[model samples]
Target: MDLAQVKKLMLRHDGCVALKANTWSESTFTALQPLPVEQRGAYCVLKTVELVYLLCSVHPLPI
Candidate 1:
């Protein structure tokens, strides 16, 4: 999906935001600064299929 579509989906989900981070970048951790404490919970991780499903649900495209 495109960045615009991804941003739209993220906005629709409450208290959730998406950040594009390189796996080896220290900025990845620094970029988490804006996320609210309550939303941060224990950790931030998601399964690949789960993420794909969410994106598809939000913006289904023609096959």
Candidate 2:
């Protein structure tokens, strides 16, 4: 999606957006890197993928 769509989606989803980076997919960073700072909304990079994998691997919660 284009930047406008991405921004709108994020706003619609309560400003919670998760961007994933891996060997297989186009990196979200690369796509947004060229945009001027003003166009880029607030965001943070987190270890969400690792944390999710770890959580699932251990099955910490009762299913």
Q: Cα miss at 32, model 1 (Å)?
A: 23
**Candidate that scores best on lDDT:** 1
Candidate 1 Cα misplacement greater than 4 A, ranges = 15-63
Q: Write the per-residue lDDT of candidate 2 for residues 1-63, one digit (tens) a residue.
A: 144544565577687745455432344467557868865554213333443343345332121
- Model 2 has an lDDT value of 0.45
Candidate 2, residue 16: the lDDT equals 73
**How accurate locally is residue 28 in candidate 2, as Cα lDDT from 0 to 100?**
47
lDDT per residue for candidate 1 within 1-63, as digits (tens), equals 355665676678663745445442344356556878865543245333334455556544222
The window of 10 residues in a row where model 1 has the poorest summed lDDT is 41-50
Error of 1 at 36 (Å): 31
For model 1, the local distance difference test gives 0.50
